[model samples]
Target: MTTRHLVDPELVALLDLIPATAPSAENLGQIRAMSPRPPVNLAQSSTLSVSERFIPGPAGAPDVRVLFYRPISAQGPLPALLWIHGGGYIMGSADAEDSLVTSMVSAIGCAAVSVDYRLAPETPYPGPVEDCYAALKWLSTHGDELGIDSKRIAVGGSSAGGGLAAALALLARDRGEVSLLFQLLMAPMIDDRTSTLAEPHPYTGEFIWTRQANRFGWTSLLGQEPGGPDVSPYAAAARAENLEGLPATFINVGSIDLFVDEDVEYARRLMRAGVPVELHVYPGAYHGFRMVASAQVTETSARDQLAALKRAFDRSV
Candidate 1:
């Protein structure tokens, strides 16, 4: 267990700027409305292009909004990434991830598509995951028109988005609908059991995302309760009994983040199940530490992610 004093000095400085109040599940709408939307300027902004559109969603559901980012200098169909945004399953939008998505477009040299899936407490369970799956299916089938290499599509996200990416990988494998090239999970929220752990891990869950907040996020997403026997693996990825057929995976988390234990365990299980996996745990960091651009750890994390994505894209080429 770590203490606030043990966290990275840069991260510690950054955390001191924000008020340390936990969000209320019942006031998600208000909180989401108040969330900040920062503008992003890609390093190679002139060479990258972005497009937006609405695609068919799961039957009876609203159309899903997708933002596509591509390199204007590309000579041919590019490998693609279906990016999901993290919001604890109750808040966030494609707009919220615009900066990171564009950065990936420039760094990974892959066409990126951000999915605007519905949030929970309102949409719940299959609703959010299905929306993301629908967007993935649309992208795969429309690869020709989108100038993408259908077979090289990968799924990725941060926090809750990371959880969705993992779940989407499982769904695609089970349904045989879309073939994925990779899965990138950053501080992913995977185990619903996390909130119910008999003895919670100390030194973690104290900054950024907390245990009480986690319970609210999971409960909001699961509709009923989290960690239930009948919970689907597609919703709570850590609940999966078999992790054999998933794609090559890249998992990263801060040693002091609430998700560190779950993410580490999942990576171990994936390796045991004979799946290709890469795991990175940064010490003295907290959840979403990569968001601190000035911190050296943030640059390292970004470079590591780009390296993994480059390897995946190269294999596809």
Candidate 2:
């Protein structure tokens, strides 16, 4: 129930820019068949070589899709990032984020490996997370062959991708597997219980993620219900009571994002647990606000975020 009068000019403009009708379920197959960013078009750039393959997933589990973004200009042993693309873990592919991964490789000078893990409504909890773990494990195990610096590797994503990264960081640490150098999370959907009446706020009310979408995503992820008993912290990060021993984190969230409070709380817990964290909370911005190209703040956010990540990678490398 966002009142038109209460909306910001940038938000209004971005809303106007959106297509009136998005592809529906019935049109998805047709659209994918005709789309330019399909699996075959995995290498979206002539300047980069996009390697497509199926990486082994969790033990006894199915394989997961993965795409590598290696810049043509970059030489051997490039720094790498295991990126998980965000679409609420429902709809999104590495091809759709080709430009994004390319920008990261060019801007940060790090090779990017984008993971197209299993999505929800088909594969539930531990499915996507396990897929991401397998990808990371494979990345570490084969780091030398890929010409990536194993010690400088990081994990990142926006929204659901961020959620997966956070979970992966915890899982990686628990398993004593890869030593994660950095985690870049942008407006992540880290919590499934955000729609609780006990935590009502202005930020939670107006964002594109309504209470309904949260319910749908969480239900799909959990395969039964959301905000219920016996939810694991790895599945929904906000449920983690102990936040120690995670990797150094860089998080950027809009003040108006629905998960703003949870992000703030997570940062606080991370700090208290002696985990170094850098957090940026932008005002008058909503979740996915960085996607609005016409919005000056959105573009500014992109620049600042990219610069921060580049700095982090430089130091980590």
lDDT of 1 at 233: 94
Top candidate on lDDT is: 1
Best by TM-score: 1
User: What are the per-residue Cα lDDT tens digits for candidate 2 across 267-291?
Assistant: 8889999988888887777767767
For residues 185-227, could you state the per-residue lDDT of candidate 1 as single tens digits?
Answer: 9999999999888899977998888998899999999997776
Model 2 quality (TM-score): 0.89
User: For model 1, what is the alpha-carbon lDDT of residue 59?
Assistant: 97
Instruction: Mark the regions of model 1 whose C-alpha exceeds 4 Å error after superposition.
Output: 38-45
Task: List the pairs of residues colliding in candidate 1.
Answer: none
Model 2: residues with Cα > 4 Å off, grouped in runs: 1-8, 16-37, 40-46
